[model samples]
Each structure stands twice: as structure tokens, then as C-alpha cells.
Target chain A: MSNTATDSSETTARHNEKMKRIKAARDKMMAGKTEEKGLIIVHTGTGKGKSSSGFGMIMRCIAWGMPCAVVQFIKGTWETGEKRLLQAHFAGECRFFVSGEGFTWETQDRDRDVAAARNGWEIAKQQILDPRIRFVLLDEINIALRYDYLDIDEVVDFLLTQKPPMTHVCLTGRNARPELIEAADLVTEMSLLKHPFRDGVKAQKGVEF
Target chain B: MSNTATDSSETTARHNEKMKRIKAARDKMMAGKTEEKGLIIVHTGTGKGKSSSGFGMIMRCIAWGMPCAVVQFIKGTWETGEKRLLQAHFAGECRFFVSGEGFTWETQDRDRDVAAARNGWEIAKQQILDPRIRFVLLDEINIALRYDYLDIDEVVDFLLTQKPPMTHVCLTGRNARPELIEAADLVTEMSLLKHPFRDGVKAQKGVEF
Candidate 1:
């Protein structure tokens, strides 16, 4: 017991010393990184939480009292829990636009889907240009691009020409275009390891939404 | 102009019909999935949003008036934005435990880290058994496991034996063990394609934190 106690104290001392060293190193590293700019964030791949993560950023923006807009491309009709919560809590500061009629598989008509996507893009372009909107979430815009509904070059050019220098934009969906990925400041690909849907478990409220 | 207007209206009608069919199909799929059970969710990979996504779920739980607990294993010292927000807003319904001393690279002492991890596990095990807590987030527990501070078998065994059958649990971190993956009900790996940190951008308030 006595040996154990002594060893524990020694361990604490060592841990403290180690932490001090790390803090010093981290502080030094951080000191060199002072540039701050609005990020073009992309969330893509075949996993859960791509759009959910985008909403998380919206939560952060809300906490900071920043004006934000969300234009959901392919997930409009469902009464999502997030839509209800955000609409109720942050009506004035946030604008939620559901542009897509439904999933492409459901729509099936390429022309109709393209028209809907173009409509959403027009709204998204307006949001991106609005200086009042600090964060613009082009939710599932990548899907529209993936399906060739929206011109990738045009979207990229529009993003590059935003008026406000500090307006952050987040695009969430699977199969982000190579051009978008190249232009993005931060990109997170949510890879799927396992999904409940594969096991016949349907989407759950307050979890999937 | 007349042709364009006519085409637009026709597209809208088609989109509406498509959405109606989707809603019906979705309703039928949802109706068949009536069973509700506790989910073992794993959020792992080298991306940025694993913990952020977990916290988003916490927000959902809060909206539903569910009691939740967070046991942060490897991210204790940082004054994360999520921690501040959750603590302030969901004070009574949530319990936030910062159990780890710091990151492994910072601490550097294996024995000390092990002891700290063990201590956190004790708290987590208690939270898991607590009947009142509906959601328990073991934030960065995988990091502790990666460093061999905690036994994967023991952790998995404990999770499998939770008292309350309805308590959902989320484990977040990179390098999740294969055993844990096999046992998880749902798993998402946040794959990193690009990060501002790689470009020497410092972690920003209300964004990275």
C-alpha cells in the first residue's frame, strides 16, 4: 500500500511536468497560427451525421447570435425535428428553406429534379450574397451536383465571389465534386462503418432527423 | 416566356406528385418499424465532427426533455463551446463529467493516464447504470482505449450489461477497437479529406471548440 501511494504521487508529478511541456509546445505552435478567415466547409461521404453536423454548426452560430440560413436541397417534405426546433427557437435570426421536393429516387423525373435544384440554387445564391447572413448552409447541394442538376463550376464561382469576406458556408451531402473539394477550406467525409438501416432498423425520430 | 412558365408549372405538378408517393412509402416503412431499443452508437475516424455530432444528439435529447450525461475522457482541459452551452442551458437535466487529465500527448505518463481513465470508467459505469439518464455520451473513450489505458473487453462488457434497457450510449473518438465496432448497433467514421488545421489555421471559438 505504501509503495502504491508513493508511486501514485510520483506519477502525478511526472504527469504535471509532461503537461507543462505540452502546453508550452502547443502555445508556441498556436502563436504562429493567427490568420482568421471564413471557412468553406464540406461534409460528404457515406456515413451518418453529414447534415446533422451542419446543423451543429448552426447551433454554434445561434449561440453566438449570428444570422444563418439553411437551404435543404433533397430533404424538405419530412417534418424533421431540427426544422421544428430551429423554427420555434430561432425564427428571426435564421431562415430555413426546403427547396427539394423529395429524394431523387422518389422524384425519378430528371427534368423536374433539375428544375427544383435550380430553384434551390437561386435561393442559395441569394443567401450567399446576403451580407446579413453570416453562415449559409447549402444542405445536400452536393447531391444536386452529383446528379448533374447544378453546374459545379457556377456554384464554385459564386462561392468564390461572395460579398462578405467573413461569411462561412457549409455544404453537406455525399459525393462532393472534385472542384468543390479543391475549393473548400475544410472537408469532412463521414464514412459509414455500420448502419442500422442495413439491419432493417428504420430511421428513428430524434436520432436520424 | 409563356413556354418557360408552362414548363415550370408542369414541373411543379410532377414534383408534388413525386413527393406524395414518397411520403406514403416513408409512412409505410416507418409504420413497420415500431420497436424501440437502446442504441450503441460509435462515432470514430480522423474527421472533425465526431464529438460535434454526438453533442447534436444531446441537443435533440434536450429538446425531448430527456436526462443525459457526458463523461469526457480525453478532452477535459479545453473549455469547449459545447460544454459551456450544455452546462448553461441543460443544467438540471444534464451532468457533464470531465474525467481525463488531458490528451495523451500532453500527459505523456502512461500509468497516470491509466489511473485517470480507470477513474473515468468508474464514473461512466455509474452513469450507464443510472435509471434517470436516457443518453450517456462517452466522449473520446476510444482515445483512452487506443492508448491501452482501459481494457476494451471490460468496457464492452460493462456497456452490454447496462440496467436501463432504454438508455442510448454514444462513444466518440478515432481508432475504435474492432471488438467495440462489432458490438455497436450503429457506427459512423468521420473521415477527414481536408482541415484548416493542416493549413495552419488555429482552432476558432464557436467553430473548432
Candidate 2:
């Protein structure tokens, strides 16, 4: 029994050494390869900075001379200053698309919301698949998907099928689909610990936007 | 001019309100979005947690049921127990690709080093663009990009074009590309305030993955 135990211990040591050598070799081969890629998703109960998080990424991509597509669902009628700045400064470099119709309950038109969502989804779908467009920000996509304006299964399927290496995609909104979380590479839940709105403070510009 | 000033002040106030409203809406939406979506970039000049920090995020992603891809660039031809554990346990759910080519000058093969680098890049690209991929950890990607083994423009372009509204990408490497630094929505530079490595202690497994 002692001999057998010693034999097993020796075998384990040898096995460990072999594994180390193999890893070293693999690391070498990996270094030989070139290319790096990925995406970002920011959704959580929040004090702030959900869409801003997505937009900040957009600006960063642009500074690197990369093209980006922004698709804002929900707040379609309201004019966001970001849309204006991106258009004027980034002209031809950055593209922004809105739902054209306001929001779900506000409009009280499910058909319009569905139609508007489809419009944004089409743009996002194309950008997600494109190898040339690196940073695709699906601004406020959760509400649309939540309201059943867009099919979750179809969206998830497309995300699963995307190709090319190094493409970065970002989805910012509340109520992200469960399947999306399951399928994501990294997930961050921004649970809102507290907010001023709860204190009856009205929304303010610049600071809030 | 007075009239214009009044209009400007009113517009700014309105802008603040718009920001607040949007933030509130996002918070409300987040209540139902339980799945976490976000990327964690672990970077520091001097610290034991560079890789550890990244691996922590990886562990979190796995717990959430999201698949992960890890590419280690600098630590070539080294035996790491963490790498083995991830490969053995996570196996199908995770991929641990190491560059075996050793350090840049240690091997004295620039051409081969470049080729190995390119290989890592290829793997990274596939992982990053895979929408189903929840997280892609570019371990030491900053080093690769800094060394010019990986093309900066190509990396940025890929980040921009990858599927949007999905995919979370994490870049963990020192001396991150200035452009990449600018492009990151959330950039955290890990400063090496103090480390065992500085005092001549060898790297330990589990502590430095």
C-alpha cells in the first residue's frame, strides 16, 4: 500500500509538470495570433448613467476613428441634445435614429410602438451584423422589447449568430430580457441604492442628461 | 441678445429636465431587468490583481450563467494553475488560450512573436464578435496593442462594428492605447502603487492568474 501511494504521488507530480509545459506551448501559439474584440451591456436599477454609459462608449469609439450607430427607442419625439451634437460634429461619422413616435403608454398605441420599434430594430440589426461598424449602441431598447414590440427570441438568435472578431455592441435600457442575460458574456446589475427623484426633486438638465 | 440669453437659459433648464426624466425612466425600467449586462476591465501598472481582478469578473460572469473567453498575451510559456482549472472545469463553457511563445525578446524571434501575436488576435476577434458570448477577456491586450503586435486601428474598428445591444468586452493590459483609453466609456487605469513583484517576489498561482 505504501508503494502504491508513492507511485500515485510520483505520477501526480509528473502529470503537473506535463500540464505546465503544454500550457506554455499553448500560450506561445496564442501569442502568434492577432485580433481582439468584444461588446458592452449597461442595464440595472440606477441612480443614473445608463444611456450616458452607452453614449460615453460611442464617443470613445469615435475618438479612435471608429464608426458607430445609435438607435434610441422610446423617447422618440423628445429631442436629445446628444443626437444634435453627434450629427453636427460627427457628420457622416455617427448616425442616430429615433422611433419618431413618443413612448408606449404616452401614445397609448401598441401598433405605433410596435411599428416604431421595428424601425429601430431594423437599424440595430444591420449594424450588429456589420463588421465595419464597431460600436453599436441600442439606446433604450429594453422598453420596446419589454412591451413586446420586438421579439426577444429573434433578437437573441441574431446576437448569437453575429460573426467577425472584435465587434463591440452595447444595449442600454431597463428590464433587459432574461435570455439576454443568460447569453451575455458579462452582466452588471446596477441596483439603485437610492435616488433624488424619490425625494421629490425634479429632473434637472446637464447634470441629469 | 437679451432675448437670446433668456432663450438659452430656458433651453438649458429644459435640457436639465429632459435629462432627469430620462434618468427616472431608466431607473423605473431597471426594476424588471434582472439579468446583468456589463464589462469589467482590470488594469493596473503595479498590483498582484491585474489578472486576478479580471478573473474575479470572469467568476462573476460564470455564476450568472454567461460564457466567457480569455486570451492571455504577456505570460507566455508559463504554467498557471488557474488557467488549467478554468480549462478543465469550465471546459466547454470557457476557453483559456495562452500564447506559448514566451516574452517578446526572451525567445529572440521577432517574426515568430509577431505571428503568435496575430494568432491571439484571431481568437480574440472570434470571441468578441460572438453575440452569444457574454464576456470576452482580452487579458494583457493593452500590452499586445502597446507592443504593436495587435493593430490599434483594427482593434478600434472591430470594437465599433461588433453587434450592438449585446456583448460585453473587457480589456486588461498595461499602457492601454491612448485612443482606446479615450474610447472607453469607463476607463480605469490601475496604477501600481505597490506590489510584491517590485520587491523581487516571484508570481504565485491563484494570486496572479
Tell me the deviation in Å of residue A140 in model 2.
0.9
Q: Which tens-of-lDDT digit does each residue in A1-209 have in candidate 1?
A: 23598796786677667767877888788887887778899999989988878877777777667789999999878777668767876778689998897787676676777889999999998998888888888999999998778999899988887636788899999999999999999999998888777566767655777
Give the per-residue lDDT of model 2 (tens digit) for A118-152: 98999888887777777687877877777667898
How big is the positional error of residue A108 in model 1, measured in Å on the Cα after superposition?
4.0
Candidate 1 docking classification? acceptable
Clashing pairs in 1: none
DockQ of each: 0.37, 0.03
Model 1: residue A175 alpha-carbon error in angstroms: 1.2
Q: What tens digits encode model 1's per-residue C-alpha lDDT throughout B114-138?
A: 8888999999989989888888999
Which 10-residue span in candidate 1 chain A carries the lowest summed lDDT? A197-206
Q: Looking at model 1 chain B, report the run of 10 residues with the lowest lDDT sum.
A: B1-10
TM-score of chain A of each: 0.94, 0.78
Off by over 4 Å in 1: A1-28, A109-112, B1-34, B107-116
